[model samples]
Target: MGTLWYGGKVRTLVNEHDIQEAVFVESGIIIDVGSKELLTSKYSKVISNEVNLNGAVLYPGFVDSHLHMIGHGEKLLRLDLSDISSLVDLRETLIQHNRKLGQGEWLIGEGFNENLFNEMIPDKFFLDEILSEQPIVLTRVCRHALVTNSEGLRLAGIDESTLNPPGGVIVKEKGVPTGYLLDKAQDLVKGILPKIDRKYIKRALVTSLDDLYQHGFVGAHTEDLNYYRDPIGTLHTFYEVIDGESRKFRANLLVHHEVAEYIMQDQIEHDYVEKGSIKIFADGALGGRTALLSKPYTDAPSTNGLAIYSPEQLSQIVQKARKFNMPVAIHVIGDLALEYAIQAIEEHPVPSGKRDRLIHLQVTREDLIDRLKKLSVVLDIQPRFVASDFPWVEERLGEERLPYSFAWKRLLNAGLMCSGGSDAPIEPIDPILGIHAAVTRRKPENVGHPGYNSDEKLTLFEAIKLFTLGSAEAISNENKYGLIKAGYTADFTVLSEDLFELAPDEWLNVKVEKTVVDNTVMYERNKD
Candidate 1:
């Protein structure tokens, strides 16, 4: 006697236009979907409770194929520099945050983007004076760059003689550590403070669950559960806690690339809870200008982005992952990364195992797209990235490069399976906003400029498909969360308006009416 949901437009999304008026739910599973007269009559005896949806448009709850749970949750814990667009803005914010801190302790902050600032490069001198007497560390918006104060750099032993780590950068001016770090260089000073506590991670995990649930996400493949290599960092502790208890949400865990080889060899997959997948980064992001490229960046004519993995390293990984039944997901942001990823797949001819995926094909040439059609590849994209970078893209990558980057429409036309994701913490994990950006190819509120590769916009149906079925298919979870079919999970989202009919420009204005999971109202709008 769970519940019966009636009088709503329930779209199964298997067909392009299949919207029904009722759905039956019991034992956290969908029992039936049909007209109110049809379903109420079919499960009349089994339903002990019935709620009228009153014509709300119901869709399969979104499945974000890629997300970072612990990292996202801990965002609530740090100093927010989201508004630090200029040096003046940062100086003002940091000066204030430091005053609230205890003396001689670490004053950590995040969400600063160098590209957004007027100077484009903030040095240690700026940090030293603004918040004197405190060891300060601030991460770039991408988390790939970190700027620390003189005291902090001195504490970490980064001086004029310090050498940059492989796969990382230690920025310097005139041979002195400028207090900036890139990629692998983050390890130099992170040891100054201990990792976040286990209990805090547990709290973050539960909080992250409801946060995702409210956004119509019932499940996600957490791409890097232990990327920090600390075995803590909010991921390991939360994983242990969930293993000890029954949880409302389900998460598929992907081991870090560094640890996968050992785990695959040591009968480790069975040793951990919810471990059946893996994550790897092929290249960096366009924001960092390190994502490997076929041609040099237009802005920086001297160099193309760097590739993180060699062909041999990637091939060995391909072979290692095949021995286990787990899926593979690689982060390939630019064309060179895409090519390297494809080479691994092609050269090794990876076995047709379970859930082999190439994620974040964010920037690629037509030739690579042509080749992608040949491999066992899928798309796990951040539509909100389009929403976020609309104005900056042309300036960053140049107009000639804009057409192939974030090519949503072309991916659709190429008959590829694409799923929508927020890449939260990296982008705001707002599914409605992501969808709006996908359909409209414009920034939220259409304020700044049209999106890069605007021609790549998807139809309303296609956009929905990415968040639902396409995402489900990526992790082999489609049987449950992606469709409104009988036996699927009783998870659906209610929207204030039918999204298909809205003017493209107005899509960003769409609101969530409610989010339902396991036939229970998980989130509902407050009229006030």
Candidate 2:
């Protein structure tokens, strides 16, 4: 028996203007797509169910090419400081939240951007005044830096005497620890946080997936093995959530390099979950001034940036992954980091069918783009970054580098494939918001403002392709997923309005009507 879906505008994505009236799905695979009359007549005998879209618009299911699944769930569970605009507000919020915590529990908060604060940076003195007796750790929005109280420093055995780890920093003033940790130094305190059990891991994965379904995401290529610190149990938890429970969501897991060998030894591909690539971090983030760059930051000239791995070290890691027939997905935010990543890939190339991914090519040059075009690689970009980091980012890179910073359209025009992501928990997880950022290239609030580098804006159709076809291609699943035509997986996202007709701003108000995966309705808007 098959399900027939009709009375909707279906964007096949085969071309810009290919719209079909109906689609038929059987056994979780699309069987046919054509005019309503033709599909209804052809599958009439075997049709067991019929779905009436009622003037909605349907497109290929959305997929996020990069995100931390468990981190998203943790953000939901922990105290969120993303909205605290000032230090006074943060102190008050933490004071209120501290009252609800159990004895000896660390007061953990995430997503604080000092850029919005009148007090340019956070210090331990302010936290000590609020709750000097207890330990607290507040992570920056970028997740590359954090500020903790004196108690937290004591618990982690970090002080002025402690030397900074390789590729990490402990911010200090006058030989005194200021409770700020950058890059890998964040692990010092995070490693000692109360260990989470399998129960917590399962809960986080389930919570994140449910949230994704509601947001119209059919699947995500996520990285989470490093956070949970239990490779086998975490992998099993993913299996239990997606396959055992029949959640009907697809997941392409990218195992971190630290745990790659363990995962590769026992990797199994199921209907809903599959291991994809080896995840590596070549450098830190721009916000933390840790992203390796060819030139010293224009704003801060003390140093260039932090490189997580040297050129030789990065090459060795890529070669190790290649030995197992696995592709490498390295995070590279600065041009220097991108150069290291490109050199490593050129030194140890993956198989022909597989593709290495360079995540967050935020700062790039024309020469690097030319070099990238010659390789078999995918650029996993977070479009929403433009909305969050704009005019302020200009100050960091200076005027000369503005042309290549966050150049999404330029990369596509250069004939390089780019997959879109929100980098959720850092940015919002909504795919519509991501598409809007790509199309408008500005924050929603800045209505009349001609976006920062308006020339880099993507067309509406091209932005949508980043979440659909481009994401599927990143995981090498384009053949069976990310399309509305026959022989594709029966995954669809139904929206209340036709995005093509509405402007990018209107997309923010559009509702997700239905999210279907494997011919099963996973989420539906409540009419009531």
Candidate 3:
């Protein structure tokens, strides 16, 4: 936990400052970020361990604003159908996965972005008949929708007469259900599945942390712990695993409003952890056409997206959280949901002293930008979506909606505090690839390699700030995390090459040379 160095071009994303040339570390914190000569003359002992980055780039390790612990672990253990296009491929992958599991055992899979599929929503009836013995639940790329084959649905007592949840819809065609569940409808069938135990969950969390480190993330906010058992216990588990091991984590955890309330009211106590913001859901995602759009879906006529909470209910929740001096972060994806969130927040009128966090601020009107600037709303966004979906965004939302979607460029110009996260399990959580997408606004996966609304792309410096400093500000940790100055945690990511000099396409292959957390090497690339 002392004396660290690398020869990379040091990037100090300091406030009101330019990038620094050199960096020095000691005692798990940045000692100095000035020229090399000054640092060398000061800390001369055991200088041989100086990492010869050889002109690579050093930047603040990613601070993923929104992430899940167990959900990401599901990616490693589940069937990864993200790249599988046709129904044939899906069946093939399932059949192959079934081979690895027992005949009657349950199989969980993740990452099937229907938007990227050629057939979009496939016939789940076929998938049900193919793997009837095992109950397989593969989530869509967007958390807003899920498809449960007939067998999985039938087991949960969902049939033709099954009514949809107030905030969700069970997509049924003819008298029978189509194995598709949108939004809260996912819980209908999911409730029937057996829960993972603490031991397995512990393993999953550890594995996910390892994956995040590989992507150059040193610390993160545990976003989905809101749904886990003893969300506080989840944080301690994460800290305990990281503490004893070489790979450590610096984390800010978001808990459900009820949980935060319990803690703040002195009803609960956990000395092992620190408090996190309150995470709440506003509406569904745009991919499933459930984003609570102001207008009806362009593709699916006659229906607007669903809202999870009415205005008054959301208002009360915000007001209550403010009384406890807790930051409340809400997820709003569609323009309508976005507007609804703003109105409720304004009506609730929390005193101006608390953090205002808006998760995924995906669809923004120009006026919303001004509102955010005035309200000081911290926007937690996903740039990978820009890279992956920009080519098809216009097709999905039409040219009109395209202008306001993923408005990173406009948000920055308006001087709104914005943070970047990959929304893993939904998007690849690689910070480098995420940065590339943020800058280029192009997804190589798409056929056209189109830059969707190119003017919305952010500059290199600005984008890096989102994954680092901007994220820190969201949780009110900017003074300690976002800077490389003395007393800041010596958390940094070293890439194989200088990112500023690389072509956009080269991002896909760029490897993590090292990831340091708490002034120690957490992840070092294999030297094969």
Candidate 4:
């Protein structure tokens, strides 16, 4: 039987003030939407069920344009270090976590940001002083680098004699390995570590789905290929997530070029999964100084970051994806990396309809906005990054690059499509946090610090659309989801309060009252 939902404020978000009070759903599709009296009088006979919203505010479910689902899932079960502000805090946390680990078991932790620490970077020796008996690997918040203890390095066979791998760096000091591996070099230790089981990978995927649902996410464009080295194993984990009975969300899997080939050859498909999307790494992250930049980092003048792949190499990958009518999403953080990505796309043109993406345009030239508009490349941005990186970003990029970095509003004004994401596990998976960051362009609690660029702030409606319509466009599903119009999918996020009515700071405190997909309530705040 079809359902009729009414009795609350419904915002289609086509404009700042487009509101309705009722929506009719049949076969999991919105067939009509309007005022309660209008819809009820129009389709009274067809409706068999009803949901009273009780004054809640309804919006289209959020779509996270870029994130690593498997990693986000796995991190949920790992030692969390995302909030440590000092070395003493880190040491104490690790010492306590180590006590729980069995003898000889590796103690792996993630989400550490060295920028927040009194000491910029923690070396291998720092970890060795606390948990030296067993192996230890602490990943930076960026996930582009990691610091390991001597025992962990020994297990990976890294030493003074080991040369850095292509596209990766082994930070060394006085001809000795410093226990920090950047970018590709992370494989040195990751390859040797005991692999996670397929069962756990599946469990992690399920856990991430539940968590995202609580945050009002119904769909996401996620990359999980690197989580498991075995391509088949990674695919199996994804299949389990989508095909399992508990599955309630949709995911567009952005496969690495390596895994994309396998899936293409095998023709893998699922009801809740969309394939033919390829993911590429143009460079590393800015915080790690691995994101390729045109000029050297102001703080470190000796090196100008690293380019993971040559322009020619990226072009070749793009060409391959084009053959399959797939979209290619490149991770570009610096101007240099963005330039290389543009060059590759130019040399190897994709089909006219496919929308390739430029992820993390944190530092880019304003002049390139026109080129991006012409190429029809969507900008997949993380709004939370502005809140997390500001003030600190000044130290890394300096004043010269400030105008062009995180220029989301500029790009949008220039007629380029920009979608929003959390880059979850890197930031938080909460869509409200992303929205607050986008609208306020400042930290929630810090009112004194000037925004990185206040002029780049988006309006509340503009920010919400980035997670709805803009994200749907990025995934090539704009007409199917992202709106409350008739014929759109019946997926909605019901909030405790009207977002537009709240103060800027109050948006951060907003909670999800319910999450509905296909006219079924997937998450209820009270039950959770």
C-alpha lDDT values of all predictions: 0.73, 0.90, 0.75, 0.87
lDDT tens digits by residue: candidate 2, 21-101: 999999989999999899888888999999999999889999999998888988887898887889889989998999999
Candidate 4 minimal-lDDT segment of 10 residues: 240-249
Each candidate structure's count of clashing pairs? 1, 0, 0, 0
Candidate number that wins on TM-score, 2 or 4: 2
Candidate 1 per-residue C-alpha lDDT over 1-528 given as tens digits, one digit per residue, 9 for 90 to 100: 767787667778879888788888888788888888987777778889987777678888876767778777767666878667888888888888878888776888877876666585677888888765668898777766788889888888998888877667788888888888876777788766556566766776667776776666666667544544445343456455445234445566777767765544543332224564667777777776777888888878776776677868977787667666555688888888888888877765545634567777778888888887887767778787776665665666787877888888888799887878877677777777787788777765456666556688787888888888887777666776689998998878887677776766665566677777666666677531
Give the per-residue Cα lDDT of candidate 1 at 347: 64
What's the alpha carbon RMSD for model 2?
1.2
Q: Lowest-scoring 10 consecutive residues by lDDT in candidate 2?
A: 114-123
On a 0 to 1 TM-score scale, where does candidate 1 land against the true structure? 0.91
Question: What's the residue-level lDDT of 466 in candidate 4?
Answer: 92
The numbered model that scores best in TM-score is: 2
Q: Which candidate is the best by lDDT?
A: 2
RMSD of every candidate to native, in Å, equals 2.9, 1.2, 2.9, 1.3
**Model 3 TM-score, all chains together:** 0.92
Is 2 or 3 the stronger prediction by lDDT? 2
lDDT, residue 54, model 2: 94
Error of 3 at 186 (Å): 1.0
